[model samples]
Target: MSRPLTATINLAALRANYLLAKRLHGGKVLAIVKANAYGHGAARCAQALAEVADGFGVAAIEEAIQLREAGIRQPILLLEGWFEASELPLIERYDLWTAMHSLSQVADIEAATLSRPLTVWAKIDSGMHRLGIAPSDFPELHARLEATGKVGKIVAMTHFARADELDCDTTPRQSACFMAAIAGLKVETSLCNSGGILAWPDLHGDWGRAGVMLYGGTAADRQLPDWPQAVMNLDSRIMAVRELSAGEPIGYGGGFVTERPTRVGVVACGYADGYPRVVPSDTPVLIDGQRGRIIGRVSMDMLTVDLTEHPHAGVGTAVRLWGEGLPAAEIAASAGTIDYELFCNVKRARFEYQG
Candidate 1:
């Protein structure tokens, strides 16, 4: 028998999440399929959302090409844009949208000969100070891209720095800075990502980038118009059952000592399977539909769970790492991380997609 470890991806939940973004943000949503749709299988997720999403956003030309090859006909935006001048023609050939984040990109566009004018997003580094033109200089940069005549439909966009903090004023200040930068321009703006869409209802734009939220991550505060369903369910199974007396220790470094007589189920998954090893004992898991907590240090290929609460669970009992009955966010929070990292780190697990 094969290892029960698998990631079940529900495409319907994914589509519904995309629609939720549209309903909440009230605009065109570029469903972020970058990072392989945050490790939920990019082609499948993109195909599921192709009919509803206004467009799709990816990290680079390579990802854009991957989507195009997978039959994604909707407009795909190269969120990070071209890495070299050589990618310009390929960007044109793929009929993909590219972001103008730096002056070198602006220069590249000016020097390159393309088959036609390109739809470019003028990225403003409002406050993130990441990969965008400075807000103070964005208006002029917008004008410069326009003057190049090779550019068309420049969408002004900025990423929020602290939008996940519901009470933080950074997002608002960043929005103000971005608006001030493009105050006189008649360009359609994209200002909201998942965090902005969830926490700042009053703030939206003509185009909103829906990222991790669409994958049913974030929302740590439960701030949403509707409860978005998690699309991926990571599951594994018990390999052995241990009957240990009090004072018995589990896994490496004797991280967790058994309190009272205990039942431990050795699961066929561990850190190498993308489960965070630092998530101290008591990280949650679902065993045979019963809630249980991980016990002790996670190993490279296995982890142990306290099955004392679950008398009926034994070898081959279904164990859910997260999704559906168990939420990944809950586990992530326990690990001092975010669900995006958890979702993207999943590897070596057989993926099964369902509608």
Candidate 2:
């Protein structure tokens, strides 16, 4: 028999999430498929969302080109924009939209010779201090790009630094700065990410960039909309079962010691498969539809679960890592991380896609 480990990608769920973002924002959504659709397979996910999405956002030019080659007809935006002047021609050939984050990127566009004017998003660094021109520099940079005459329509945009934290005032402050920066400009604006779309209704504008939420992860402290569903169901099967008495140590470094007589079911999943090694023993997994706790340190290829209460479960019993009844958010919280890392780190598992 083949390995029982599999990461199932549900395209239907992905589409539903996209629609949820669209509905919530009441505007166009740029379905973010960067980092290989947060490791759900970009080509397939993009194809799944191509019909309804206003456009797609990717981290670099390569990602956009891949979608273009895949025959995705929707507009593809380079979220990070062109890295060098040489990429400008290819960006034009692919009919791609780009973000002008740095003055150097603007210069590249100005120097390039294109068959037609290109759509550009002037990214303002409201407070993230990571990318984009400073809020104070927006007017000067916008004027510079306009003088080039190569830009057809310029959209003002910024990324939120703390939209996920409802208690934080950073997002609101950033919005204020963004508004002030573009006060006199008539350009359309894009401000919301997944968190912004869900938490900051006032931040939604011409476009919403939906990322992790579209794959069934919560973006903020609030509850997820009912329409969004888990796009990835990561699961494996029990490979072995053993009985251990009290005081028996489990896994490397004797991380966990059996408190009583125990039935241990070894599952064919571990850190190498993207299950976080640091996840404590109390973390839960579903075995034979019964909740079980991981007993010790996760190994490279396997992890042991306490199955003392589920004697009926044995080899070949189904185990859910996270999905459906088990929310990834719960697992993420236990793992001292977030759902984004969990989704992106999945590796070596066979993938099955259902539309």
Candidate 3:
């Protein structure tokens, strides 16, 4: 069988990042493994961090159940909480925590009758306006949930809108609002995500949700004393190599015009495989452990790279799209995007988990 174009994940590195996040926050770490641990394979990553993470954070109730089925004993916080009222039973069965952001969720909890009271977190909408309850309604929301005998514990939390921008004052302002809204509640709090955990220490609370930072990506450009290793090395093989003459166009729509006699390497990966489709020619791709630039437009199943400077180019050679020696942020830049996009877009067909 042929080795498919795939990404190799470093499980050790993931654990290190989780440990670092915990150390930085000086509190419990909720390893945010949502979106398949940002495409690094949630089950694998969570299993590796089970001993270290105080808990896990996932977007859906099913993901929480998956961890439980996989033997993960740590508390799992549902980031989106229960989408439907019916999910409450499963959440309670798994002892997973839910983030009650809206009035409907409060009603669901009130209607629930589990053997054990449900652990709930109040998500305050300081500014993101994505989810969470309004600051003005925090008091009333808290009262309603507490009134329900099903409430086990309540945590006050909020999401940061500008956590990735170091200079953005919104993080601090949001923190103030969250604190004000939850005043006198006397419960544990959690407000920090990846960016907040790494850059804004003040945002750290009783618990922090560490995401991208635990995957070896820097948030807010803040440098850690010992950065975590890249967990995913996305690579493909060189299918063919060709020599081109000056003035000759390369790839579709003539996006690349050769400046001189040049060599092009065709790689076996494309947008269909989760490589960005918008990536223009001249995007950098590592060939044979050497830096090479894309020569033409990206296609659905393949893309070409300029290999004039690579002396050892040939068939079946390897190309590092990201991770390993190549940084994801750099690859994202070449494709006119961000590291988050590249990580999240990794298709299911390509994968090899190290953990």
- Which number leads on lDDT? 2
Candidate 2: deviation at residue 12, Å? 1.1
Query: Cα-based RMSD of the predictions, in order?
Result: 1.2, 1.1, 1.4
Model 2 residue 79 lDDT? 93
Task: Tell me the tens digit of each residue's lDDT in model 2 across 310-330.
Answer: 978989999999988788888
For model 2, the stretches where C-alpha displacement exceeds 4 angstroms are 224-227
Q: How many collisions per candidate?
A: 0, 0, 0
Q: What are the per-residue Cα lDDT tens digits for candidate 1 across 1-355?
A: 8888999999998888888888888888899999999999999899999888899999998888999999999999999888889988899999999887886678898898987999999889988988898777876787788899998788989899888888778989999999999998979999999988878888798888999988888753555556668899999999999999999988899968998899999999988999898898888898888788899899999999998889989989989999987888888989899899999999989999999
Worst 10 residues of 1 by lDDT: 219-228
- State the RMSD for candidate 3: 1.4
All candidates: TM-score: 0.97, 0.98, 0.96
Ranking of predictions according to lDDT:
2, 1, 3
Question: What would the C-alpha RMSD of candidate 2 be, to one decimal place?
Answer: 1.1
Q: How close is candidate 1 to the true structure, as a TM-score?
A: 0.97
